[model samples]
Target: MYQTTSKKTPWIFCKDIINHPQKAMAWVWGYISCKHSMMYTLFVYTLLLILVLLYYVNHRESEPNHDETFKAKVQQSFIKFVEENMPKRDQNKETRAVYSMRTMSSNGSLLEDEHAKILKQRAGDIQREYIGFKNKKPFNFHCDKCAVVASSGQLLHSNSGQEIDNATCVIRMNNAPTIHYEKDVGARTDIRLVCFRSIDFMNKDTLMIGKARFDKMVIWGMENPKHKKIKETFTSKFIRKYPGVDYYSLSNSGEKKATRLYEEYLGMDRLKSNSWLSTGWFTMLFAVNMCDSITVYGLPDGNQCSAGSKKSILYHYYEKRYDECWMYNQHETRMKTGHRYLTEKAVFKQWAQMFNISFKAPAWNLTNVNASEPIKSPFISKMEKIGKKRTKR
Candidate 1:
């Protein structure tokens, strides 16, 4: 019999001792595991905090507050301030007056009743050439003294100013608002005929810009705006109210005849004649119809203006370069073809010599005001001598 004492008995089985540990030992292992996990979490949090701090410092350095640098201060105070205070120069006045004078002068006499009635009756005649009226009344027109002025690029800086001004009627196209040394452009023109094809040719304020009382003629080449169906079209809505304004159409026969003459006789490879043909041809036609003799000026001379580094001179319509200038090629081509047509003008001039039709060129020079004998044509020797005497005075 085993006597049981008050002390607790221990079961020391090897398997039980190996498999199970005391409560204190298990608690110690759990505490060590939790401490390791906490250390890892703290390490990750510290790294993230460091990255955020670095980003904040870099961002703060990149952007600065106002009043920081010399570059900004100079841009704000000096450069921009100076630009705001600069003044623009005004346009020259003589140029303005010349154009004003051109538009102001107007003198055109309509065909008298007898002449008009005759022309109307013969409108369908289909004759070889136009025949003059049978009992032709004496026309007040002094066509023998007629002059035509044209602006060419070749005339720029050419100092040919006085010669240009001496003409009876200086005809120019699309006269721009004048500026320094260009006052003669406006002042010398006695008549202004506004030629139009598209509405884009002139602005609504063109009449106001010239500020002169001039006769305005609207030419509707092949493109007639009034016939088109579109509303607000350029031709239909244009308001041309000054006196002496008239609208006329070229007969299909006239156009065909002119085109055939140009291509067959003049050797123009291109089938079409541009604005120059339309206007130049029309001008010639009108002159033939109304005037006994007509003189031409400012037509193309085929000499181009030289480019300068310091100054830019505006050229006459046909004289400007083909690429850079607007509405120029058509005029140039027309001029070349029309020049061929006017070859007969030399013959006409010879005929005028016998009949006493005076043809004169101007004698003024922009470069040399004191220079003598600016007239270049041999046919007008007497006129040149007179011009020289006038210049001397």
Candidate 2:
């Protein structure tokens, strides 16, 4: 009886609960809470570690190693190649002839009384404009850098006017009429070089070409006597207003001297007889004479429709394309002359590289021909700023 009472006692019951039931439940709850806290801490630590690794990688990539030896070697090699391959200016009789031809072609009748009078007047104006700039202590022409810009019809779409304007002096050639005056021509051009064969070809704002018309209706009213007089009057007023501007006259007479000047000095030759004037010759001659750094934009890459193309008959940009009727005996003429035309444009490119003068074509596609590296213009900086702002948005 005493033993049975001990088993049901309150003390016995308390001991059992402490040893097993309530104690075991408390221990399990404490262990589970600690495990959960440790797991959460580990997860957050791993996430922070991954983020730091990504940041470090990105920062490393952003840095440029300007001191890299490979880059220096490449630049040295390029400079050496250019120095070796380029043609140095020849101080010989051939060079003399080249210069005389270029001067005579651009400035008409070197010994003529009218030519002398015009040159004397222009010389005085040039002196007056440059005198102040030359009198400074350092005697530097401040921003005398000149740029020649050529359009190969490819620049019709690219907005390159702002870049062109950055030049102190800009030279253009032929019938390069820009539809956007303020943005394209007016903004950039400090000087307009026109190769007018006749006074009749001159228009007030642009050089008018008779063959450029697509249809009869386009040039229908241009033939009128009143139109001609109005054009002449407008041109006279425009020139009078801009007296500082110079005008160059080329002969339409198609002489051999002109052809030689076009070929030897200017680096252009006829692909076929009776073809149009070479646009390449015009740009090269002007660049060599007037500008230090030349950037040609719109000139053909020799693959596309150039000034020498057969379709030039429709547009007398230089002159009429050779006519079949003009060739009397095809076999005899062909056999004798062979191909007088320049078949490769690499010759011009070679000359450009040799001079250490930068030549670039911005609108040319690199898919077909080996591409040239474009020199970064000031305009690119402005564009990059715009691009960054856009990316942020």
Candidate 3:
């Protein structure tokens, strides 16, 4: 009966509260007010949690945040390797000779001669126009001392990175990688000179690596059928996706001038020869015009072309097995289509004497062109091998 009476008492109280709604509300409100501080804190915490969740979702949708950790790690690993394997060279640093542009003089024999004047007049407009991408204004830049790094196999195991990085500006050629080989080739890439044919390869490297390794890219070559195909496919897509990369191209007039310069240097007609001027040719010209003091690395000097003296090295620093001398010989001997590599080396020797240019990594003796021997023909080499076998017998 006591348990029954207790249950009935609670029910009677609930019935009174249900009948008098104002009293029930007053009781509930009094209880809430007494715990107001705790309730407010819980509400504020919930609101903050919702805001934090929204921020996290927004951040995740954007570019994957390595927060530059990936780039840093890559650099760090390469740096460690360099320190362990090839210590930096701080002694006997190479010095640059003072050079200044000669002004117009009455002698007319120097650079400001009538012919030079005409060429400058033609190039004046194009030189000033930087040609930025994505409707951005082009920035002006200059390098007092520039290092033009080549992709020759001579660079392998050279440990020339420290010296190359000391330059004011470093220019790299098409599709040459400095990531893994940063110890041999400097980690700095101020400008990349790419030909039309190599643009697709460069883009592929960029896409696969998920990073643009160069600051500025200057493309040269005629807008041929192949280039048109690349433009419609890779180039357009690259420009749209990577607006941060500064893209520039040499004008038709500029290319013509460069070709003319090559002709003048080689003392031959390019069309008649049916030969391609090596990229090194254009790269040297660019260095002459853009940089005050130029130092070239990894290009075989004229003396190295001789049969006896030629060091057996790979055609490219990255390529392991291809013989550099053999390839040069094959290309130089091609009757219809080939680069006159030996001839070009002779021309470069002449230019080195004239300009404030110097070569290293099998350095050049600019005084003499006597040692610039032609690469021996592959057939002749084969016949010589056969003769040697007979002699052994």
Top candidate (lDDT) = 3
Once fitted onto the true fold, the runs of candidate 1 whose alpha carbons sit more than 4 angstroms away are 1-144, 157-170, 174-183, 186-195, 204-210, 218-235, 240-253, 267-278, 303-393
TM-score of 2: 0.36
Best by TM-score: 3
Ranking by TM-score: 3, 1, 2
lDDT by residue for model 1 (276-322), tens:
34344444434434434455544432212112123333344333443
Candidates 2 and 3, the one with greater TM-score: 3
Work out the TM-score per prediction.
0.37, 0.36, 0.59
> Candidate 3 has what TM-score?
0.59
Q: Candidate 2 on 1-393: residue-level lDDT in tens?
A: 455432223345335534664463453444345555676445445544665687689987887765565544543443343233212223444443344422332333333344324323432332222111112221112224555555443344356667766766665554455444324432444433333333334443343222221110001112234456644653466446433333322222222433443343232233322233444444454344344455655443443333234532112222345432222123112322322223223334533443323544433333322112211212223223433454456
Clashing pairs in 3: none
For model 3, the superposed segments whose C-alpha errors exceed 4 Å read: 1-130, 135-140, 205-212, 222-226, 369-393
The parts of candidate 2 lying over 4 Å away from their true place are 1-144, 179-186, 198-201, 205-244, 248-258, 261-272, 304-347, 359-393
lDDT of each: 0.35, 0.38, 0.60
Q: lDDT at 76 for candidate 3?
A: 46
